[model samples]
Target: MTMESAKLPDGPMSGLVASAVEYMVDAGQRNVLFLDIMRKRGDQYREHVAQTAPHVLQYAAELVIDGRKLAEPVNYALVRIVPPEGVEIDKNRRPFVVVDPRAGHGPGIGGFKADSEIGVAMKAGHPCYFIGFLPDPMPGQTIERIARAEAIFIEKVISLHPDADGKPCVIGNCQAGWAVMILASLRPELFGPLIIAGAPLAYWAGVHGKYPMRYSGGLLGGSWLTALTSDLGAGKFDGAWLVQNFENQNPSNTLWTKQYNVYSKVDTEADRYLEFERWWGGHVNLNAEEIQFIVDELFVGNNLAAGKIEMSDGRKVDLRNIRSPIVVFCSEGDNITPPQQALHWIPECYADVDEIRAYGQTIVYTVHQTVGHLGIFVSGGVAKKEHAEFSSNIDLIDILPPGLYEATFEAKGEETASSDLVVGHWVMRCEARTLDDIRAMGGNSPEDERRFATAKRVSEINLTAYQKLVQPWVKAMATPQMAEWAHKMHPLRLQYELFSSENPYMATVKSLAEKAAEERKPVSQDNPFLAFQEQMSKQIVHALDSWRDSQEAMSEALFLGIYGSPALQAAVGIDPKSTPSARREMPPEHRAMLEKRISELRSRIEDGGLREAALRALLYIGSARGMVDERSIEALRQIRDEQGGARMTLPEFKMLVREQFFILLLDQGAALAAIPNMLPDDLNVRREAFRAMRRVLSASEDITGEREKRLRQIAGMFGDAVEEGDRESNVAPFDSKAKAS
Candidate 1:
């Protein structure tokens, strides 16, 4: 080729540069379009708010308290939510305490509406009390103080509901989840079943590409920024910063669609958007010390999962120490708190599921497939379903034998279904799970742990340097006026600013928009713009997804590179050590009794013959599946009558059967094949039996791949036997045998 041809118009280098420029211009244009639409939507949102301000103000005014007339400033004071007229508290019912999270948001979310956790408890004939705080914390309020106040509140709730079997059932959401755990550990006697929703305990455990939020602290140079932020806030960190982080997790929803949703469907979605904003925009503050402790001891340090976190008096905050059943609610799709973060703590803190059971600690976790973080608490559909089931079944969970179980819910229309089916007609069963099963979801490894440990060390150095050199200057310069200004000017705070009278054109547009909506002129569902907006929103979402993926890759690479190095690996040992003993200090009598029970269980298993174990396992499966069938129940009744009139209660009988199931699972073989239809065809009973079988398998110690192989072999034998019977080739042979006889 000639030089002229190669160097002429649109040359090779120019072509590449031009392509880059074109791509940038296209992206810029799309962003500008999105911003313009969002701004217009923002204006519309403000207008709608202005129109509804009067009615909302009136409703809010009804509950307003005069600042000068506030009660004594103790965090733990007896408080009651005055039930509305015609709604009476059930004096005889158990009491419930709903603790709302102060993480970047105000209180009342636990009871934000009528169909909520509080509402469900109320409908279930339980006395309900909500633990909410003011929009601001008291000066110098510490987390320890809050914990003490909660304990006091529980005492009052207990005294009020004297006849209840257990103390008030505490429901803690998000940040409050940890707070509740702390309270429970310090004063275990003041609590009942503890429900922690969307909480992260095993903060260091998560899947490789699924949880990117955990890497943000290390990526941002550790906890120094947290200290700097707190110092900037005049020793009280603004919670809006935390809220802003949450918003950034999903930019499209927070930046564009959140407002667009109201503009496009202004008439229908306006109330919901405003109601949620009322809670979301009201940010609270945490003491600098509290934030630092959370960062060093929980998030960056991952000390809580390691059983190293200690209080001022040096009492360890061992989650395993709490005697109450812990019901962990998390979601598979929650990037903020994934299933691994919520669940891996069990295996990390203990050796096996049996160890957990041996401690008499019942843990039941329900992992939703696709609900995001806030949906665990906010979505009415979710609250009505999941929360409702949990509240109704606390008794069942409380009594369930110790083991790792995955709680599942299935919708049913019939009333005569399994006992796991609750009022809403959803059948819930606890499936047995193994450590390997739990490990499959966790991305934890030696390298990841080492990197986290390094992060912890770096955080300590950063914190010390700031405290020694920079903190005094920051506190001296940051006045209360400056802190207040900072809070108001935060980007997260501006969500409330636009709706205020600060906008000049708000009034006229407000009237016009309200009139337009009232006149029945609104955007149709089929409107081209609405469809276009959704499509564009999805594209933005995809862009955010790409960004998240890139960040996750870098994080994983950094972790592996830092921890996988020979020097670092030698410095920090990350491989998990041998399982720890479960000999927790307790009353001598109780300990001895527990040991004796374990010994007896072992003795029984050893003495029982393999045939007896197999037969018992088959019978147990029959009992489980039998609960679903009328005929099976009849057979059980017949056996009971013939075997000298029933002796054990149903629960006791079920327990006996389960013991046999585990014994059989320990020695798996063709003998197990003798029992046919172990899992019945009836959907309800089959599910129950499957769950029961899992419980037995999880409780056993000798379970391994050999047991699984034997089960397969047994299944194969049964299949072969069925096939042989089906074939018709041996009739002449049978006839010849009969003639010879």
Candidate 2:
């Protein structure tokens, strides 16, 4: 071989060396950029912390009512959102108020983005308002005061839109959900329709092995630690502790995956990560009385669902008292607030479906298959779909019959029927449901209930012991300066403070990162080293996840073992062999009210003319399918709009619908027979009412199956004939002999 031939082999080796050197240089630059992003994040956190009232809301807003100025003061305030350019508000439409949860973080997650709860409502032409709070609680503030303040804010919104077609719609996200429920229960007359997203009302309710947060109280010896922590904070609990608990739930994400993703995609991911961190790092404070009541009554004691929570005024907070329609939005993939926690409250509060209707309440709940807890409120996709559908169909939900219903959505496509009727990319349908359906979603057995009850008892004992033993000394030792120092030293805060410019070491990172950005040379996507780096990152995530699983398993086993012991049950004054009671007896006054309402409805069963006849016919047709569709509702709205004469307000419409539903529910055959009497004597009026009913039935699709039979029967009662296509009609003819004269 010649020397030139030998040199050719060196050429390939040198090329490989050059590629490796280039990759290393790019990797070094990326490191600098990543660190700089972290520095900026830290700086953002510091700035957010320093603000008097920091929120992540992307919209400009004007303060409407300050809760601090209410007769009962609180830190919360209600603000009206000013629509951006090109967005118009319809003052005649129902207004919307979005309340963010005050759990750990500062408020604004509901309006964190342009495509959020507030955004969707505004896009749908509703005047929007937001309820947010300051970073610190007022001294001696309590949960009851905050709820009262919210009621005042809602009253203000109602007054602002006196000419609105309906009362204002209220949406509460997470912790705010339960707060809204409490307020609605206390003052249901002030609300129109309520949407609660990712709220946990039944705290002790959860599927075994899936929800770990519920077990934390048990493993930590109940709420004694909560009280201890409050005392240590000088009567104010640092919300960073709550945020830390949330972080601890997912070790892999918190310890590695989150930071690694930003580092790997630093060029594109920095702004998004910093935006989220600004809200995540902004911790707030809650009064000791507030946190204690939350942990004691709602979390550990599980009193809210049972109607055992009495206010300082001696009035009990019973969820059954709420008169407004409630729409519950939960998700299966939410580890923080699982479906069981969100929905089991219904069965806990009401004994059966009949009881639900007895109270004349409409409850519609939707469960997402895969979105996590935060995604329910934070994801743009969810906001555009579920929130949008709810906003556009708020009136439809409000007018639904008093019963249990499950709302589901499907994507709109060419195959979708009545696509024109759908407002956006999805179609919503609500099917009548039962208490048994809610129970089938999975919950604790009698044994599991006993265990939880025992845990609650133990928590009470521990809390009492702590109050008598350790609380006094801790309160005596705690000072404002000491509390402030402890808060600054929290791990969650330390991470931001250390990486920020406040640290002398991070100063050079900005200049280095700028230089790297100016001379950016990114490595190829197919680089072998880059692939290797990704694989290593995956391994790290897997290890951290494994560690988390092990820790959770251990905690679960310990909690169950301790709480499930017969001896422990005996010690806690609970009988291990007895089943836990899940139902509460109806108060006599509520029972009497329901009886009087039923009698009133029965007396009006044979009343009214064209409107009542049309509604009764629609309800009869809808019963055969056991479901309600938005398209049919839109058809009704169109009829009302196009007629442009003697329109019924939403409240009147709701009352008519509910009245007709109860009539049918009381006596289906008698109600059907009375349809002819309810119709006007004029032939043209009768024909128009029948056509309107048919239009609603055929709005979504061609009437077929059981629904078709029911519709034909209705047409026959109207003295009209419906054509059947080359087939013998199975629809039973209306018996003229039984018709009302």
Candidate 3:
């Protein structure tokens, strides 16, 4: 073996040997340098703290005044975002309310900068309002109470903008995502378009080896620790705990790179880092009840997908009950909330896509190939592109027929020129998604469902026992005095406190820090060590991610192997939603109904006539082909209009056209060539058809991104229609080189 090969053997031993040597070399250096850097960083941190002391003092004073002022107000506020320098309300314009997530963090991320969510809405000339809260919670605030308060808040926004749309478009981020969902479900009439970013919904469902946060509750014996922590805190669950959990998920950044990057790039990165840290470090508390409810019902039980979640009044919080168009933004690279956790909730809640159509719920989801969880909301690049596209196309998304669609944002290449009609810099396509496509993500297996069910049961039993026997004593001891003391001592809260006038050292460093900040200059990007630092940072992140994945895979294997075995399966019992197991247990009558329904659909497929068949086939083919633009759609429409009779009603016309379109695609030779031949020269027609297809897709029962891309290609085939060697003759005269080639 080579020297290198000798140094590193194969299998487990190789990893051990490599790790030991690396650890010995770097660990010693890291131990020495890490302490000195940390001490300096801590000094700098305290110095910055000293500078911000006055602001913290002022904020604390304002909080005291506000708390006293709102002694009798309950949950109500007149939130003014941008006070008019001199701008008047346009009666025709709508209003916007952006609710920032209080997910173990303070508010204002939605409007942290001038070019943020609030900025976009204001730029659109909408009357924008921000729903923010004090760092401290109300004496006894529950999530349900917060949802009701949000509804009331939106109602007030509507009242302010009298001539605008009746309801305001509410945007929720992270934890607030499910809150808005609950609000929309409870008060559907009060909401317009609902936007959820980086939201975790179907928590139980995720990719095989990604997003292991949801698995922790089960592994750690459910949410008993949440209750224990709350009890220890004397009632209020420390939001710092939640923030710490988030930090733990990404150890490399939390432990090293985040602060290191700031120090290394202090000049330019200081302001941005401090701005983000202001929010990131501003952790807020939740009631013990609130945290328990979230962990037990949403995370462990996965009740949202099961449609078992209830409101304070015991009313069910069914996701399908929400009438407004729901927009879900997720990413493949998001480790906290993967696309499966964010988007799969729809399919999990509904039996199939058709059921979604039957319920008249408009659900649209977009999956970015690679963007981290925070990037979904905080990345200016994503905000400019994805958010901008969604903002511009809100009306289009709203008008789509009730169904499920995957919204895709595609940047136009140099070959593609921008049209006068396209508002956004980028172009986009909305296509249907299928149930099977969603199921491919996870949480479908019989064993997986059963394990989750067991978790739910354990949580219920544990929570019930805690509430029955221990809650009274805990509450009795959790007096106002204790809560206040706990808040003052909290590490997250202490950061603010230490930076305020309360610190004896603050006055001394305050002036020096100011001058230092003003004179601050960051390390050069071209510095040799800078590249090494970044490389090291990325390597650490990758190692953490790999470790996380391996842990998840091992956990899943153990759970499935142990609980999924025949003996354990028989002993543990299975959930009704569990596949294979549930399918086997279906009642005779329900089974008959399902079989009959399948047979009926099959019969309808077989008996479909030429026109109907053509339309169906076209829908299928158009779905398979990437028929995104105006040309292909116009051809489909023209065929429909020509074949459609003037006397036909809208429904009849649609049916007839759809039928004919299907038949055209089903016929191999003539129909395929004929469909393209009949299409008008104007690409606008294809574009409209593409839009129509999206609208239809929205109302479709089940469709998927993969299938939609395929359909676009099919439509493109028509646009691509070429006669071999007959191009010079111009016999067809429909010779479009771009399409054909």
Candidate 4:
């Protein structure tokens, strides 16, 4: 071979070396850019921390009522969101109040973006109000005081929209969910419809292997650590610790995947990462008293669902007292607040479906198949679909008869029936559910409950011992200055501080990043070295995930072994042979009240006119279908708007629906037979009412099966009033003598 031929091979080697060098330079530039983004994130965190009133809400807002000025002072305040350009607010439409959870982080996760809970409500023309809190709690503040303050905020909204068609719809995300429930139970009259997303009311309820967070209290020897942490913070619990606990749940995500994603996509992911960190890093403080109550009464003791919690005013917080509809939105993939924790409270509160109807309560719950805990309120996709559907159909939910329901949503497509009636991209339906269905979701077994009961008892003992033995000395050693130092030094906060401008080392990163950006040479997507780097990252994530799973498994096993001990149960004053009481007993007065209400409803079974008859006929048809669609509700709304004298306010409509439902529930045969009696004497009026009922029933699609049979039966009962001219009805009115008997 000639020397020139050998030199040709050298040229290919040189080119390969040049490509390698280019990749190296690109990688170095990407690293600088990533570091620069982190520095910016840290700076933003510091700026957010410095703000006196910081919130992550994406909309402009005006303060309406400051809870700090309320009679029962709290750190929370209510603000009205100013709609953005091109969005119109209907003052006559029911307002929406969004309350973000105060669990460890500062507020505004519900309104973190334009496609959020607040955004959807605003897009639907409802006035929006936000309830957020300061980073620091007022001295001696408690959860009860905060709840009262929220009630006052709602009252202010009610006054502002006096002409609204319905009461304001309140949405509580995460920790705020139970807080809203407590307030709603105490002041049921103040609420309209409630949307609770990812809230854990049944704290001790969970699947054994899937949920590890529930075992933390037991593994830590029950809430004594919480007390110590609170004391260390000098009467204020650092929310950073809660954030740390959350991070600890998925070590792979926290330690590797989260940072790796931003590093890998430095060009596109920095802004999104920084925005989320702004909320995640903005740690808030809880009053020691408030956290103690939350840990002892709610988390460890699991008293909230049992109706065992009593306020300082001696009034018990019974969830069954709330008259408004309760909508629970949870997810199967939420490890933090699992479906069991969100839904087990229903069976705890009511014995069965009959009992739920007897109390005249409407409870609707939706379980998403695969969204994480934060995604329940934070994900834009979830916000657009589930939250949007709930906001648009809240009035329909409000008018639903007393029962348990499961709300399900399906994506709208070309094949969808009555697509024009759907307000958004998804169609929503509420199917009647039973308590047995909730039980099938998987809660703790009987043995598991006993173990948790023992854990609760142990927590009480440990808490009492700590209070008497260790608390006094700790309190003496704690000072406000020391607490401030501790908070500033928290690992979560230090990461931001250390990378920020405060750290002189990060000063060079910005200039380096600028130089790198100007001479940027990005690697090809199919580069072998880049692929190797991604593979290595994946291995690291897998290793961390394996470590997390092992740790969780060990922790769960240890908790179960320790808490399930027969000797420990006896030591904690629990009998091993006895069953743990999971449900609360209804008081005599409450039971008597329910009985009295049912009796009164039975007496008026034959009463009411066209509105009542229409409601009864609709309910009769709907009962056979066992589901409710949003299109049907929209048709009902249209009918209400079109009719002159027959138009009813939402509240009046809700009351009428409930009354008619109870009448049907009490006497199905008699109620159906008496429909003709409730109709007006005029043939035209009867025809109009019958046509309206048929329109609602046929809104979604053509009614068939059992529903069609029930509809035809209703038409037969209407006789010539619906068929032709002035002909007397064949079906007779209900016998007043039989009702007296």
Candidate 5:
């Protein structure tokens, strides 16, 4: 065979020529279609911003309660997140209230689709409400004022749903996570279960090399820039800066990947891309005081979670005041609020497990293996899996005794059926976890903590200096026109304006794109040029990522170099040798103050009636294994739902469990001693309570080992022996207690 024949193969040249021509034309048209849609996407964003920035939310909503109309006016408003067709909400069910982050963008990401937080809640038959804000803050809307307004909103919701099982289950996303936490603390009775997703409470946390956002405050010259920015904005800080900061963290995603994604699959990707961009581009504003307080008190001072923040009315914003069960959802891949930052607050705020248990605080957390910060809230799969599981099982979670737990989720085995559980699939179990487990996740480096401590002092000095020296002059020159012009000129906003039809150059692109679509062709997957194009795009993203990493390393170094110095610590009155960063010694008076309460608890071990005894016994058996699952939670809920005996509200039930658990902890012997009096004189009554108690104990699957022993001890209380240790006791038998009622 000739060499030319070998290279060309034996196929006819016409087929190859035709395929090549087709591929070229397809690639060209596809490229044109991509550009065409890109122009239109830009136009959509422009239009969306012009007419209500958060037009991305697909669910229709109606104003339920306006905060401005309240006695204390604020920008926040409570709106009922009306579900889409095919989903029905029950008013008698526990309400689910979702609060979107106000970090930069406008609201509505939570209900961005049918498969979002709101969607999952609605699908679970939860009455849903959304706490949203306006683009412009009220003249003087402080964070405290907003929290009060939200509390009022929650009050309104609760009053509207008197027949509901319990208070609303509040879910806060990102910045809103901390905001709702603040609300929960101020008005703990207003909530049932609190879910904080990707919320960074411990601002100064994370492992140095792995997480970089923690270094931002120090690297940006402490938080004086925040004050300066607000001043320059004529007392209103533009939210665009915060959005720009997020974009700067991952330029690959911001500058290239987002646009490139739409460019590559323009035909299919435009709607989704534009939908997200609408929410992303809708920037909001913060009053100078609001932004300044966030920067000075949170990011810079890190005081809220520390229990040091004093509210306007002199009430301390202590996290311990949050009585609602808190479920923290975070991710390892979340650069914005990494697991370290999200989870470390527990360790910082509480000395140990004993302290957490002492307060009867139910804290449950789950860390996603690889989802990013945004994915925690925005990903549909997460809504279906994690959130679905959460919403469905919140009732079970509410009844759990106060303690720390790590929520474990796993796909059900093949034998599992759709009818067996909530969401018909995933199995969730809460296993007890220790503070050590969280600290092991790089909770807070001693060195880094000290650096933040030093930075906090430096921040105060710089902020005061800025207010006195830089503020007056900047405020004098800054005007309403300049602020308006500056807001319009943001790079992110300008990009959209440049590509929309508002710019004359983009006028023909949409029409041309539509024309090309009629004759559109798509390139074959193996086309050499297409392959090359993908490789080049990957290289661009990779280079940008590498540059980002380098910048992160540089920022961390600069932060530590200035703030980590012994000199700086000394200058700031920090004696690292004597004073630890977060583990400072409790003042003698403070310790003494709690001692009385502790002593009272220790002394008052034997107390309460049948309700206390039953609740105590339930907690004792379930917690003996230090892990719990909802295998029998359905029965438990049915039991709670049933109007049998003295019906306990969720809070009352929780209190009984807590009071009993603490009593048991203080003096198990005394608790046992008090048990006989706790039960009824009637054997039939005792029998019924015993049967109910056993049902509760058997809810968890792990009824072995220590649990087996506890079960035997508890079974004895039924006045019958199930095993050797289960000797008949003062309590009546199961049949008698249950049958009597």
Candidate 6:
């Protein structure tokens, strides 16, 4: 990152040698400066460690529940975020509960800065709570216990906000996302709109050569490695190993790019580098039971996506049981949890979009073009746009009829929000998206899935063998002191100790570095030798990247060759070649329920009050558009609020919206035929209801095409409700005074 200079002029040969000599002199100074900064960083690192043990959270918090006191103790606590000054918080708004991943790192990245998940929610006037864990897991604490504790924490948040508009809006980052979904499926009554960012839901999904984390299980001989590691730690696996695996995913960054960036700009980059390293180095530990379950059931088995995961009480966890609306945020640049892993669960849970709609589920997702895994949660721009928009419009997401949609954030010029006239910089619009949209992104490779299925079976065999053979011996040899020593000796942890002033040999380096700062000399941007050094550095990084790529390719080839063979497929109880699945007819009981419901709807098609008629008509308009935007919903909300007819509770209205949408889906003609039942003989009253429909349909600046045609069709269904003069001048959509009434 050096400044550019004019092209080198053709000059005398000796001049080149002189410039090289100056470049060497500058290089020597930078080397000395870098060493000094490193020593200072070591001192800072030691001080940081001394002050912040067990956990590091930027925002101050007061614990509400200590899981250790529970019947099944975990090293987790539910805390309330105390928003700093200048942030407005509304206790009446839906509570936001953010859970950071327990995957190797300390908690609080969700709100470590002013522009974060919690930060965005609080900015939108939400009461924010966080689920943070201590450094060590409680003895024998399992992922199931943690999941239950998280649910309890959410329940407490919901109890504190009983007067809020809806249930708590839950956010789960990375590995925490699956736990969030588990809680939602188990206790769907306690949650609201869910936001799961960069979490791997479909663990066995990925296009070949694109995502290789799934392949590591088979390559490493399955979950035995997890068992061995856990046994070595004396029933508590050090999380630094997890952190090292993540770093190994991209060697260029871990070994070259990140360090080079710091070294090249050590003068300004030290503070930022140290800040990130603090979180990276503060590793937590998981109990043997927890890691084993994670690997056996989730990462290796991929059972969550299959709805085959079972709790200790024998209750099966099904994603389709989750009644809350879900908004998934993923990035194409995220190698860890690509869009495939983040969103493929939708297709796994539902055979088609109609099934999703039949179950009354709303799912919306946005795929960022380029942002790494952590960037999905920690990037300020993502927080400002996607997270902010989600908080402000989550209530609207709840009212949306069952369907799949892709939400897009469009940059806006100065415009007022629905309330308080706050100038907004983004307009979020929901676009019509189908299941195929997700399938394409999911890489839809049945062949790859077959290989993973083999791996899962093989892992089960290996894990059982290890537990019966090697595990007992390993556990016998493992002691508390040995475990502690192993954790300290981990390469990820050892780096900190190597630089720490706690070591007696390097005590004088601090004073030496501080004094060297005074003699700092930076190299010229255009020095010939500096250019040569940068070129060589790039070449080395490229070589390492190439080597990593070749290794992965070889591993993948071996994995496919082994697991894709006919013999292994037979061993795993599968055909080597994938066959098309035959669709079965609906079960008799389920079919009976569907038939009875359809018969009931048909019988009552013409028998409801005008209130039903209005709701049915409104739902029709929303469905015809193939998408719903914030503007449309805001208009509908105002209309519902201002109607002069019989009023209904919010929950009652929600049920009506869902039922009418389904009735329309059942038979569009029958649903339209029943619109007159919703209107009375009084012409003026009919006109007002139609006017409400007109306003809701035209919530945007304008409405045209199929929506306009549908409006005319509905107007014709109203018979004489539309007068000749009314047809000539349609109601203006966004007139403030009209909306206010």
Tens-digit lDDT string for candidate 4 (626-697): 889998899778777786574678898888888898888888988888888888788878877777777677
Instruction: List candidate 3 stretches off by more than 4 Å.
Output: 1-78, 83-91, 412-418, 468-485, 491-741
Lowest lDDT sum, 10 consecutive residues, model 2, at 732-741
**Worst 10-residue lDDT window, candidate 5:** 730-739
lDDT of each: 0.62, 0.88, 0.61, 0.88, 0.79, 0.79
Which digits, one per residue and each the tens of the lDDT, describe model 3 over residues 84-132?
Answer: 3543444546666777776776666777655567655655566677666
TM-score of every candidate: 0.71, 0.96, 0.68, 0.95, 0.90, 0.91
Clashes of each: 0, 0, 54, 0, 10, 1
lDDT score of residue 398 within candidate 3: 57
For candidate 1, write residues 1-741 as lDDT tens digits: 987667525667675555555445433443333333334445543553344121111111122222212332433233455555555666755577888787877666777777777776766666777676654556656777677767767887788778674567789998888889878878987877888999888787776766878877776767988988998888888888889889877776877678767655544565677667666666667878878888878888877767677777888777767877788899887889888888888777667776676566767788888999988887777777788777766655554545666777767543332222134545556666667777777666655666666666656777788889998898899998998898778876575566454566556555544444444433344544446667887887788767766767887677656645656434444333323231244447656977787566555654443234334553433323211222123323334455474355434544554455444434434325334434333444433333233223322111235444443333343333323432222121112222232
lDDT string, candidate 5, 164-244, tens digits: 988899999999999899878888888899999999898887887867777778777778899888877989999999998
Ranking by lDDT: 4, 2, 6, 5, 1, 3
What residue pairs are clashing in model 6?
613-678
Candidate 4 has which clashing residue pairs, if any? none
Q: Name the lDDT value of residue 427 in candidate 3.
A: 66
Pairs with backbone N, CA or C atoms under 3 Å apart (clashes), candidate 2: none
lDDT of 6 by residue, 1-741 (tens): 335764455777667976877777667666666665656566665665555334556677888898889888988889999988988788778899998899988888898668888888888899899888888888878888888888788889878877787788899999889989988999899888899999999887777787777788998889999999988898888888888889988898888888788777867887788777777777888988898888988899888878778999999788877899998999999989999989888877777877787666899999999999989998888889888888888877777788898998777643433432222457777777888999777464567777888888898889889999988899899998998898778887666777767767566665655665777666678878888888988998998899889888888899888888879889878777776231223347655776787788777677676678877877776666677767667777777677657766555667777777777778888888878766799988887778777777766545466666677777787778777765655544535554443
Which lDDT value does model 6 have at 632? 67
Q: In model 2, where do residues sit more than 4 Å from their true spots?
A: 1-16, 720-741
Writing each residue's lDDT as its tens digit, candidate 2 over 1-741 gives 887666423676876766787789888999999989889988999889888889999999999888788777899999999999999998899999999999999989988998999899999999999999998998769999998888889999999998998998999999999999999999999999999999999998887677889988888888999998898889999999999988999999999988999988878998899989988998999999999999989988889999999998899999999999999999999999999999999999898888898888899999999998899999999999999999999988999999899999989997776677788788899999998898899998888888888888888999999999999899999998998899889999999988999888888988999999999998888777788899999999899988988888888888888889999999888898998887788889988987887788778777888788889988988878888999889978988898997888888888889889998888888788888888777777777666667777777666688887787677777773333421243232222211111
Q: Which whole-number lDDT from 0 to 100 does residue 361 have in model 2?
A: 89
**Which 10 consecutive positions of candidate 1 have the poorest summed lDDT?**
52-61
Model 3 lDDT, full chain set: 0.61
Greater-lDDT candidate between 1 and 6: 6
